[model samples]
Structures are given as structure tokens and as C-alpha cells.
Target chain A: MRIVLVPGVPALLPSYASIEDPVADLRAACHHAVAELGPRVRVLASSPLGERVARHLLGAAGAEESEADPTGALVVANGSAKRTVKAPGHLDERAEAFDDDLRRALVQPLPAGLAGIDVDLAAELWADVGAMPALAELLTPGTTAEVDYDDAPYGVQYWVIRWS
Target chain B: MLELGRHTFADDATLMMAIVNRTPDSFYDKGATWAEDAAFERVAAVVEQGAEIVDIGGIKAAPGEEIGPAEEKARVVDFVARVREAYPDLAISVDTWRAEVGDAVCAAGADLLNDAWGGADPDLVDVAAAHGAAIVCTHTGGVTPRTRPFRIEYDDVVAAAIADTVAYAERALAAGVARESIVIDPAHDFGKHTFHSLELTRRLGEMVDTGWPVLVSLSNKDFVGEALGLPVGERLTGTLATTAICAWAGARIYRVHEVVETRQVVDMVATIAGRRPPQRAIRGLQ
Candidate 1:
């Protein structure tokens, strides 16, 4: 199975677009990673906003949403929003380490590690991991990971990654 | 499409028509760009400053030196042709009240005839139709060209402006001018005192409500100067303030001397009025 992970950024959706793109690089990375997914992909989003973002990216990538044995799976998630003073949720000292731990897990293709994510501490740090269980189940030991984008833009940690 | 001669714009587009004087005796420039080269330079500069159109005028509006048809043509016709060749994509408009001059400029590749005199020459509309050029129908309250208002009074200035300008617009339409190509201006200081001009500026939305595209030429004019008791050179602030109001009120075209400043004000006002999005909004949105 092929898997693509993208941050649930509302700005990546067309409805919240600005005349000058604020997340041009992030958007490009998300599209590139999503395009690598097969024509029919299953979307695992945490909320309506995440679903909307995933749907837009999937549509842009010329893919359709599917659930019955999809060729690939699209996972929508993000790290801490309070990583810095300018972040959406304001500064949180614990955000950096928490996001670093999540990043290490993702880069290692250790989706199982996501199952052990500290839900209470993640919420306290403004990290959105509602879909972690599903993502953890998808992640397996033998998969090779490719990180397309990794940065804390807008004080929100975002990752565009592909695992095969 | 908002057809201007050979050019067309989307209905929602806002245009900045920069004033480029070809006459040596224009009130604001004081013959600074009277020379052809200087006028051409103004065109280049304003185009660089993001002006969508340039209103080239041969005669000054404030009781200028006598410039007959032949003289007016001598001043602008060749310049219009040169501008047409140099900037083929730019919308070139000529400000004239004479149908003879209008015919001459349109033949020389002019796109729009800005009749600031409120259809002074009945033949101007026919000329615009023949050339397939746009026409700006201004409300001058029956004032003559190259003349200032002495004691012009309207029971309701805004109403009179709307009635006269819309009538002139309908006249142009009847004369075969394209419906979308017609624009209306209230002629702020042309046939109005400071109070009349202010009232028109404040009630400009009424003009916009006519469903006709509204053009405002309130750039450092006498009304702005009189309203703030400032001289012509110092009335930019007042001009931009009024510009913001007009833009917020839904004016589509701004005939301005300071293209950059007017564009900034119009863009900011449009953004504030929810007509336009910020160029790049990431402050809280990100």
C-alpha cells in the first residue's frame, strides 16, 4: 500500500486562497505527494476541515476519494500549532519536543509509534493527532519513507511525506 | 466585457486612467509635459506605475488658451498614434469635446473619447460609434468647455448629476455607442462648487447604483483644494481621501494624476469593502 501524509492547512484549500499564495511551497509539496498516490485513494481526516483539505488536494492531484480497497491512502494531520510565539495557539515550550518526537517517528516510517502518541499532552500542546490511530495502523516496519516537506511555517508544524 | 475600443476588461476590474496633458497650458501640470516627448514620458511612467488607461488631453479645462480643431489635432493626433504604436495593449483615451478632434484621435488609434463637456458636440457620440470607441458621459450641468463654474446651482446636485449623466449615457447608447462601453462621471469641479462637489462625492454610490460603470476624476482638483483650503500641489491627501470614498462606493474607473497613490487607495478601499482580497493575507489566516 502507498500512503501520503499532508498537513490540514485551510490555506491549502481553494476556498481560503489569497491573491498571492502564502503557502506556495507547502501547497506544491502536498500536491506532489498526493499525486504520487494512485487514482483512487482513501482519505483519513480528523475533522470536516481536514476532509475538505484532503478532498481539495486529492481533486487537484487528479485523484478520487475511495474507501473500498483504495490503491493508496491519504492521511491528513498536523503537529503543534503553538510551537512559537507567532503560532496560531501561541508559544508552548513542550510543542517543539512533541513535534520532534512525531517527526522522528514519521521519518523512521514507524507508524506504530504514532499509536503511543500522548493524546492529552498533544492536545495541551495544540497538536492535532485525532487520526493517529488510523495512520499508525497504516505504518508498517518494512515501509520506506520519503519526506517531501518538513517545516514549522506559521508556527504550525507541517509535514508532507510519502511511505511505500 | 467592458469594451473600450479594441480592448475589453472584465466587469469587476478597476482601472486607473492617468491624466497625460498634451497642451502647454493645462491647469495642474502648467505646461510641464506640453512637449510631445515629455507627454510620452508621462505615459511610459504611468504605465510603469500600473495605470490601465491614460487620458490624453489637448486643451486645459480651466479656460485655456484658444486651441481650435486643427490646433488640437496638431497637439494630440500624432501623439495618440505614437502612443498607440508604442503601447498597443494600453487603453489610450483622449479627453475632447469636439467631434472633429474625436474623429481625428480615433483614426489615430484612440480607444475612448472622454467628453468632459457633457456632450457639447452632439456629433461626438456618432464619431465614437463610427470609431467603435468607448465614451465617458460626464454631467456638466450644461456648462461649456474650458470654462469653470461661476454660480451653477442644482436643487439636488446629486439627483441632477444622475439625471443628466444617465440621460447623456442613454443618448450615447441611442447613438450606437456600445452599452458596456459607456461610463458616467459626475464632473466634480467642472460645473460644481466645493459644496456641490463634496455632496456628489459623498453620494457617489447613487451614481454607481445606476448599473453603469462610474468614473471619478477627483485627483487634486480645485474642489479638493477648496475643501481643505490647500493649494493644488498640496491637495493629494484630500484627493486620496475622496478617492477612498468613491472606491468604497463602487466607482470602477479612477481618472487620476497620481496613478500609484490612487491605485493604492482604490485597492485598499476595495479590499476593505469586500470587493477585493488582500494581495497576500497571512497574518492571522496562516
Candidate 2:
């Protein structure tokens, strides 16, 4: 039941506006979910910078540095979100370009055993709402483990990989 | 969608009919028996297990011991009335070839007339037509000898079975029975050997091709017993296997003993065939 939320490109603006610091918001969500759900909770943030920020937040939460290993990490990104905000006039071409960029981002090299990547902001937003843990379980080396998304109202596409 | 009594058969799924024999010498459950309470329990159990129809037979119809029309009608009428009273929504089918029994059962709330004699008795067809109830015409040809002597004579078994069943269908239709209300059964294990049953099942798709649903009753029959060398009690697995094969070959209705298990197997087969998988909810973030 551990959940990791990755902010969609569109929701990132509102998220940063509320928290003023995107990294701090991600870390607080993870720590809160873990404290609420007990020790089983492990929240992960997507992106190399996001991962570094998550580790720092864990230390600030009074969690031992040794207890917070690289194994619990997730990289979240939204491929479709880029297409949503692309130039409205040339929608099809811009959407295609956005998709290519998202695919490039997904296929890029990352730390070994990274947990699943979240492709949308809604999943990441769930962490702030105390719904899911910040860290996501890795289904495969580069795949996100299946999570209970029945409560998710609209379809949000996301991906995850194993935490190195 | 076609409606039989309160039950509906729209899409092609194996409609299960549990056998309920009131006679003392039924082929499968001869020694193990029922009267009033037992019959009621069996009816409830089968219906709970997803049986759309419960076929009750008064006469043994095993090999010998054929009762007169009056006796058969009396037994059928009384049994159908009791069952109908117990399960008002149940689709009760009286298994008899006597026209008198058909009439009595219809009047007593039976929804379908199951003629094992293949409508040989014109009066039976007339009764079914008069009541506007569905008819299950099974191929039970020739006289039932003392022990059912083996007979293997036919230019083409599949063609002959189809032609004979089609002829019966025509007769029932001509007798005023609606075409949709008629269901044809190849009558496995009734005056037919194992090979005959096998051939009938193999060509069962032809029955479906006739533009009507086919009901194949291979539940714990002699063929399955002989094939698996198991007793009647142990033939459920084999019967389920044959039911699966027949379903793949396009038999729409299955008369089975283990209704729930048979339903699962048929559902799995249907799933693999991509007809419809188990219901699942798709989830994602808004």
C-alpha cells in the first residue's frame, strides 16, 4: 500500500505556489505518510534533484541517515502533461514533440534499481493529501509496482522503477 | 434475447439444467433418491448453483419400465405442482414423452416440455404447442429394449442425427410451437453408443448452425465413465472436460450435475476465447 506521488507538469505550479518549495513539499508528504502508516511507509520522489532533496528531507525528519538508503527512490515525470500545455495552435505537432521529449526523459540513465516513475502530478499530489506513501515499490528494474488506484477519479498515467 | 419462463438466454453461454429424477430407477441416481423434502432440497440446491432450469422426470426411461400415459401424467402433474409451488420462479421441465403428462405439467406451472421420444408422440407436441411453453426435443429413437442392445447402422451418423432432429423441429413448428422455443438435444446415451455420442458432440456445431441453440447433456454419461474408467460419482471432472469441449464446439446449453463447477469451466473457456473476461474495474488518478 506504499504510494509515491509524482507531480504532473500542470499541477507543479499550484503545488509550488502552496508550499513555496517543491522539494520540501515532496519530503514532508513522504515523512507524513510514513509516520501515519507506521514504519512500513516509504515515500520516493522522482528526478535526480528530487531524489537528493528527498534524502535531505528524511534527515530533517529525524530519520537516521543509515535507515534512509538509496533503495527507496522513485523518479516521477508526466509525458502527457507536456503535450497538454504545448502551443494550442499547432496542437498535433507540439503534442508529438512533447511526447518525444517525455519518452527521452523516461529512457534516460538513472541510479541503479530506481523505483517506478510517476508520469502524472495527481499521483504525487496524493502524498500531500496523506493518501499514499511517498516511496513507490519498484515492479521491475524500471517498472512501477501496481498500486491501488481505485480511488483515483480521473485516469492519471505514471511509471516507476526500482530505487538504486 | 429469448425468454423461457422467467429466465433469459440472450448471449451464448452454457445455460445449466440440473437433473431431478423422481423415479426410483433413474440411470444416474437410481438408488440415491428423493420424495418431497429431498426433491425440494435438490431443487433449491440446483437453482442456487445457477441452474436456469430443473428437469424432473417421473418415468425411469432407463431401458424398460415404461408407465402408461395416465400414470405418467399423474406423477408429472403432482411433482410439477409441488415444485412450482415451492419455487414459483423456477422453470420446471417435465421429462416425459406422454402428451397427457405434458398437458398436466403445463397446467400445473411447468414452463417447458422435454420430450425424450423426439416428439414421436404427436399428442406431446400438441400439448407443448397449446401451452406455449418451450420444448426440448431429444433424439431417443427405436424401442428401449430390456438392456438397450447396441446398434451401429448409419450412412452418416452426424447427418442422420441432424436430419432427424431437424425433422422433429419442423414437426414441432408445424404443431404451433414457436421456432425460438424449441431446443434440440442429440440425446447422448439414449439408444446411442459411446462412438455415436462422440460423433454427435464432434458435429454439435452443425446443430448450432441450424440457427437454434443446442443443449448437450453429457453429464456423467456412460461414454465419460467408460473413457475415464471412473464410477458415476467420480465422473464430474471428466464431464466438466467434455462440457468445456462442447462449449468450444458451440453448444449453448449444458445439462449438468455439478452446475457451479461447470459454469466456472465454461466461463474460463469463454474468457480464453475472448468472448468476455471476468469483470474488472479500471483505476487511475483524476
Candidate 3:
């Protein structure tokens, strides 16, 4: 089984596209990460926007959603939106620490730590991690993870990670 | 594809035709670029401003000292060669109604003949065809070249413009000019009163509907000056307002003195009409 993580940015949608792409690097990262998910996949997204982005990407890559015993999974979630003063959440002192903790849990395949993430603190930091608990179910105690993308662009932390 | 000399543009692309006057008496600049070096500089500047074509004219549209073919060729031919040599990809257009001048400039590397006089010389289209050059066919209500309207009245000015310009386009087609190489202009204020010019600006979409790309030369013309009660120098605002309307109505080419301002207006209008996407739109889209 393969799993990839991506962010739900509205600019990735065709309806919101610009003549000159504002989020070109993010888009490329999303495309690369989504392409790793095989032909038949299941989507794990926290919000409707994330689901839409996942569906669009999957549709563009000629992949389809599978409910019964999928070959791969696409997880849509992102780090805190409050990493900087110009961040969407307008500067939270604890955002960097929160994202660092989440990054460690994913990179180390600490399934229990991911499952025990503080949902109340995530809300305060404007992090969209509701569907991350699903990753805990897919991951195991001793699995190797590859981090494909990690950045704080537009003051929002985004990561495209893969685990097998 | 819309072919302008060696350059070819897709059907939906909007173009800017910058005005580069070789005359010392043209209304707007009034001898500012009458010298050869100055005119060349103007060409370079407008190209930097994203102009797709340069309409170089020898004689001022308003009546001035007579400029026969010899003098007109002297004014534009070698200059066209210089510009073509420097900016090999830029489309060079000579604003001449005489076929002799057209042939000479085309031989000197001009890609278009901007017949602002509404095809006064019948053989101009033939010259354009022979050189594989594009032509701008304007409607002047049958008025003589360099002569303004004297009590010209039309039952419907827009109707007359469409009929005459479309007929002129057909004449070019019959003369073996490529179908994509011909464009039509209503020749605002050339042979019309203030009200007539205003009406043409309002109904420019009718001309666009003819399926031949429409070119509008409304840069600081008398129509805008008269309508706004402004002088020639201060009509940029009015000119841009009319340009926005025509752009919304699908005018494909703009002939203008101010290249940057006209390009901005056309782009903004195209975005509003849903024909163009924004350049880097991410205020709230991020």
C-alpha cells in the first residue's frame, strides 16, 4: 500500500487558475505526490475543499476512487496557517512547534503519537489535521517514510510525504 | 492564425499597433520624433512596451505640405529597414495609401500596410499580396485622403462603416491577399462628425461580428477631443475609455500613440469579458 500527503489549495483548481500561476511550485508538488498513488485509491480529506482538490488531481492523473480494498490512499491535510505574521491565521506563537511535532510523528511513523494529537490546540493554530488520525490507522510502528515536500509558503505549512 | 508578415498570432490574441510618426506635423507629437534617430527610438520604446506592430507614417493625416511617393518613401523605407534589422521579429507597418509607397516599404522589410486613408489607391492591396504582407482596410465614407469630413451625414454611420469596410475587405480578398492578413477599421473622425464617430465607437461590435479582425485607431483622435471638450494632449483618458469599450466588443488590434496605456485597457477589458485570465491572481485565491 502507498500513501501520499498534499495540501488543499484552491489555486490548484482549474476554476481558480491564473494566466501566470501564483502557486506553481505547490501545484507541481501536489501533482508529483498524487501521481504516486496508483490507479485505484481512497481519499482521506478533512474538509470538502480538500476532497475537491483530491478528486480533481486524481481525475487529472487518470486515477479513480476505490472504497473496497484500495491499492493506495491520498491524504489531504496541512500544517498550521499561523507560522508567520503574514500567515492566514495572523501569527500564532505555538504554530512552529506544533508543526514540528506533527512532522516528527509522520516522519518517524509514530502512529500512536499521531492518533493522540491535540485537536483543541490544532484549532487554535489554524491547522487542518482532522483527517490525520486516519494516517495513524494506515501507518505502523516501524515503517520508513519519505518526505517529498516541506515548506511554509504564503505563511501556510505544506508537506507532501509518502509512506509504504 | 492571423498572419502579420512573418509573425503569426492565434485567432483570439489581442494586438497593439503603436504609432511611429515620421512626419514633423502629425497632431500628437508635432515633430517630437520627426528625425530618423528619434523615430527609431520611439519604435524601440513601444516594442519594449509590448507593442506587436508599429504603424509608421510619412505624412500627417491632417493636411500639410504635399508628400509625393518619392518623399514618402524617403521618410519610411530605410527606417523600416533599420527597425526590421534591429528587431527582426517585430511587425513593421507603413501608414500609406499609395501603392508605390506600400511596395517600396514592403521591399524594405515592412510586414503591413496601414491604409489609414481607406484604400485610396486601388493597387495597394495588390502590393500587399505580392509581398505577402498584411493590410488594414479602413472605411472613410469615400472621402479623399488627408481630407476631413465636410457635412458628411449617414442614415446609420455604423451600418455604412460595416458595409464599406467589409466590402473593402472582400476587395482585398479578391485581389489575392490572404484571408487572415486583412483587417477592418471604421476610420473614426476621418470622414465623420463628432456624433458619427461616437456612434461608431458605441456599436463597434457590429464590425467585429463581420469575422474579419477589427482594428480601431482611436488614440487621441478628434472624436475623443471633441466629445470630452479636451485638447489633443489631454485626450488619453477619453481615448482609453473608448478603447475599453471596443476591447469589450472584441476589437483585435489597437493603433495608438500611448502603447502602455492602451495595452492595459485592452487587457483589463479582455479579463472582464472572460476572454483572458488574470496575470498572477492570488489575492484571495491562495
DockQ of 3: 0.75
| Worst lDDT 10-window in candidate 2 chain A | A147-156
Q: Pick the candidate with the highest lDDT.
A: 1
Which runs of model 1 end up more than 4 angstroms from their true locations?
Answer: A32-52, A55-73, A80-100, A118-126, A140-146, A153-155
- What TM-score does prediction 3 earn? 0.97
Q: Tell me model 2's lDDT, rounded to 2 decimals.
A: 0.61
Give the per-residue lDDT of model 1 (tens digit) for B19-118: 9998887778889999999999999999999999999998888884688999999999999999999999999999999999999999999999999999
DockQ of each: 0.60, 0.05, 0.75
Error of 2 at B10 (Å): 1.2
lDDT tens per residue, model 2, A1-164: 22333433232222222213323333344445323222322444344444443444445445422335432332344333222322222123243443344333334432131233332432222222111222322333444333211111122233322222
> On TM-score, who's better, 1 or 2?
1
Clashing pairs in 1: none
Off by over 4 Å in 2: A1-164, B5-7, B143-149, B281-286
Residue-level lDDT tens digits of model 3 in B1-286: 8999999999989999999999999999999999999999999899999999999999999886888999999999999999999999899999999999999999999999999888899999999999999999999999999887899999999999999999999999999999999999999998999999999999999999999999999999898999999998999999999999999999999999999999999999999898898887766554
Candidate 3 regions with alpha-carbon error over 4 angstroms:
none
Q: Which candidate is the best by DockQ?
A: 3
Sort all candidates by lDDT, best to worst. 1, 3, 2
